[model samples]
Target chain A: MSIGKVGARKLMASFAIFLIATGFGMARYEIKDTPPNLSRFESTIASGGKTELSGIVVDEPDEREKNTRLIVETDNVKILVYAQHYPEFEYGDELSVSGKLKKPENFSGDFDWAGYLAKDDIYYEMLYPKINLVARGKGSWVKRQMFALKAKYLSALSKVIPEPYAAFMGGLTVGAKRAIGKNLLEDFRKTGIIHIVVLSGYNISLVADTVMRAVSFLPTVFATSLGVLGIILFAVMTGASATVVRASLMSLLVVLARTTGRVYEITWALFLTGFFMVLHNPKILRFDAGFQLSFLATFAIIFLAPRIEEKLHFIPKKFQFREIFSATLATQIFVLPLLLYKMGMFSVVSVPVNLLVLIFVPATMLFGFITGAVGMFSALLSVPLGWISFAFLRYELGVVETFAKLPFASFNVSNFPLWLTLAVYILYGFLIYKLNRRNTRKNQVA
Target chain B: MSQKRMAILLAGFIGGVLLRSFLNLGWAFAGFFVFYLSFR
Candidate 1:
């Protein structure tokens, strides 16, 4: 008997599932079997002596206020290097580094610093290495250009805006590598608005949305292509971190569906995007917290937001308040268990704090982007835009700091178990299933 | 296979990956095995 259309679709879906499962298994096996080629460096690390090694800086140096962190690659293994801010190094710098090599160790908290770095294939670390510049311009040219542009943009912002606000604007616009000070960063965490500063999917989606709207006057194909291009440029400009890549992939898929006139099935798109990402890099599946949070938050917004909106009839719908409230609540609820298990600090005031600050995020980002872009040409001309952005930044910082200072702002559940997190998600799945069934039955009766 | 069976199989595959990521290989293999037996 010949299989019908539906049967064929099901069969194809089953084949896809088989492929994904097999891919994951093979990836895990490969990671477990193959080891990093650190034969040359192992002796140097164990000797506990100052060793001189030469490597090209493979990635953008993470610049903070006092110091900078760089990933230097040599002998087919990556080493995380902590270097001084003076005589700064660029992304493609080739340097001779002399330092005592040490294995990355986990800090006091449950954070697995070693495993986190290992996910990126970084096994060794150098602290305050004496670096001698040997040469410049190594690694991918595109990445080098992106890093250069990002630095110039950040410098422009600093020229126009003041210290903390300028840094915050950089974080908002391009996921700036600079630190916003430990105390302010802690305030962001306590108030649960840290995602805004991290160049999250929300930021990428906002950019995508803006681009799509701006180019909507053009022909459909041209507009869609432009939107996709904008997404790619933004992803590249932000150093194309795993989170940015994932978000960009999702946005690209949406654009593709719209251009092809196919109904965008977001759930399938999300799953397929995640599957491909994991298939490419198995370590990230287990070790990348950014990947995990981005996936979960997107899933919650898609699946849980509407159900939450249904129950928020009492909340006014003005300014799309109800929609934002539900979406924020859905994401907060869905990510709560994971955050608690990983970070152990639950922001009791996260909902109110998020509600207060998130409304201004898009405007803040827009004004901040304008301020930086215009500042690049003329810092004098960018003053008005910088002022508007500074006002928004100041308000957001004030809200976070105020809430974080409250005695009951956040609670630390340092011992939150993995099992409990899993159980809570299972409960969430069950509730969603029940709600879907109820809605389907009501629709049938109607 | 029926649509219901197809959905279950897909869910099982996803669950296996989740287990592999969050727990360990043993749990993921066990999950895959259970789903494989059911599919067979």
Candidate 2:
């Protein structure tokens, strides 16, 4: 839809607000005055190099066990503690570490990873720190409970399914972890349908869309309100992650636009939510790869899905497969350039494989969620549902394996430059602007 | 493209994406063609 003068003005204002807020945030976090207690770390430990520091594990490891980054709190001074994946540390585990506290660094001719980390107010890194677990269960009660519940849910999936499939299901339900092994993950990466398992915005969108469709029969107002609330609740349940929040808000915008028929409302909704996310944690906009991809994918789907859907009348409307295919296509179109820019890989097999797998995602998630919830109560009931979920997971995994075996499945470019990515996006923006004008004219003439 | 021509072209494009993905020649062609049509 073409944004009117008023809508364009609103968008410009929102952009300005984002610019100001982000600028303020960058300064506030990066150079925000350090606490008095942290002066010891800055002067002696941070400057003098390797030292022994005892601290508590403030949160879960940053990544899958291998070379995980843990946030440690020692004497009101937080440090980025790195360790080899072992001894399985959890949130709230007290630890003593002896390591070099070096400053974060950036590689030349690449994205400034150090600047990205600085956005989180994290400046020091302790690589391969000597960690001695002093205690456990010292974290927040809510987070601990959430982790416990998540563990139990994943165990239920594992009980019903075999190795790699169970790992895939774990990813579909919870976020991607070490469940999928190194080989299978590489296969996933090569095939390029990894987002289904990455807990990315696409997965969140699937969840949101499922909720919206389930309640679509209600009155328009009620349906929109309920859908939005349900999505917010879902995000919170999924740890209220930046990625989840952005995806939910984007879906909520589409729901509101449907009920209100003010397409420009979407631009405002996107901007406002994105603004708040960056305002809450300015680092995510710059550093979080998932957040960047999620935002772009959601925007593309919102803008291009209807057009693709309009063009996709050939596919039978049964099972909403056409709708799913259009969405998957639209999102892939939007994300492909970014993915190439970042990962430098193009999967010829991506679209078809995604279509084969994504068609089953909603059903798989439904059965998987039901199995997890029910397994918490009645094992007998959940077992049958678990098997059903396992079957779907197996089919998707099979697609990945089969496609990944092809040498021509994917081709890698050596560091697709940032400049090319930017230029491509600029051209894409112009194309979309022209299409919007054309569509608006068509609507007017009609 | 006229309305009828656009309809036929769009159908061909979708077919290429779904059916000709084996070699990907048609799929790649369809993608660029769709980009052309989207902005034309």
Candidate 3:
């Protein structure tokens, strides 16, 4: 259904609010000062000289066989410090690193590595830093605890499952992709199922469902709230859930608007969400892809998923497969051009491979969670679940490998200009608006 | 869990993920909005 004319006034108000919020956020971002500590090192860092720097490990280390990459926030600057292999450091652990801090430079090819790092306000990097653990628990208390739980869960999962599979399960459940080798990782990207590795909603639901089930013995309200909290953490880990919360809340409002026959309320809600989010972090409106996508995808699901689902009515709605399929299709339709512009590779097999893998995602994730949770208590009790998870993992890998190996499975496109990407989206947004207006007219006729 | 609860939960989960995927798509479109406005 199109946007109801009755909500037109509210929509206008929301649009005005969004614009004001956006302007304010952009201004705030521009005027924002660099961290006090970082400002001290600005000249030293800019000189491109080798020097020692100390900072708190603001995030979990990306553990690769070659090196562990740590996002360290010094007094002021955020730097990517690479150490020799895993450095036995966790999040919130402060470290004194003796290494040359070099400014990020752009890659020779189409990829803008420097710009990417800059997106998160990181301008410097260190390779093979000499790291000394200065102190424990120097960052957020909540994040420290989350990382600890994550580490424990990961260790438990690894103990029960074998290598490669264990690493894959870690990626599937908690976005621990450092253990996943480059070749296999490429296979996942080629098959376009790499999203599963990240802490996407699917992964969250898997963990949340398990958490809910395990705590089912508890009071109903408590269990449900706990499950919701699990889902929220999934967003937080990605560093994009702040936007997700805004999107979710706004969409809920829009849904409410429809039910109450106050379509304007949805538009008003959208603007207000945008305004508030921009007010909180203006850079998100301009820089964060996750934030942008959350809004678009939410809109599509709210408007388009139902239409697509009806078209696919032949497919049994059993197990919610139809909904999954439709949702995937709808999101792809909206994101394909952008994905192409960013990833610079088009996987022709993305849809089918995603469908094949996504159906098994929840199952695989569920089994993986059960294995991890049960393993925490007893390896003997968790063995059966581990085996089941392994089975799902094997099947998923088979699908990904098979599709990735197909002749011309993906196209490596380069030099796709940003202007073109923008044009495509402008057209897309216009199309959505036109479609909404047309549907409004149709409803009026009927 | 009963079949009904199972179905509902699965649907909700899938729906959540779909919303996520769409947001990702919208993100891709941000470039368009900025450029379009500039040119216009």
Top-lDDT candidate index? 1
Model 2: CAPRI class = incorrect
TM-score of chain A of each: 0.92, 0.82, 0.83
lDDT of 2 by residue, A325-441 (tens): 888888888888889987778888888898888878878888888887888777787888988988888888899999999989999887888778879888878887787788889
Q: Can you write out model 3's per-residue Cα lDDT over A1-446, one digit (the tens) per residue?
A: 34686578655554444444333333354433222345556677767766887789887787886778889988656899878775478888888888787877876765567755665668788888788999998887777777777777788888878878888888877777456888888888787677677555445444544655676676756755665565556545543454445644453453345335665444446556665665555445545565666556556665666667868968888878899889888776776776787677777887888788888888788788789878888988888888899898888888988988998888788878878988988887787778777778988999
Please state the error at residue A128 of candidate 3 in Å.
1.4
Candidate 2 lands at a TM-score of 0.76
Q: What fraction of the correct interface contacts does each predicted structure contain?
A: 0.08, 0.00, 0.00
lDDT of each: 0.83, 0.73, 0.68
Q: Among all windows of ten consecutive residues in candidate 2 chain A, which has the lowest summed lDDT? A: A26-35
- lDDT rank, highest first? 1, 2, 3
| Residue A229 local lDDT, model 1 | 84
For candidate 1, report its TM-score: 0.90
| Rank order (by TM-score, best first) | 1, 3, 2
In model 1, which regions exceed 4 Å deviation? A1-29, B1-40
**Tens digit of per-residue lDDT, candidate 1, span A1-446:** 55698888866677667756554554454564355777667777667747999999998889876779999999778899998888988888999999888999998677888878887889899999899999999888888887787888899889878889888888877898788999999989988889888888888888888888889899998998888888888788898878888888998998899889898888778877887786667667668888989988998898889888999999999977898899899999999999999889999998999899888889998998888889889999998988888899999888999999999988888889988988999999898888878887988999
Residue A400 local lDDT, model 1: 90
Q: Between the candidate structures 1 and 3, which one is better when assessed by lDDT?
A: 1
Interface RMSD, all candidates in order, equals 4.9, 19.9, 13.6
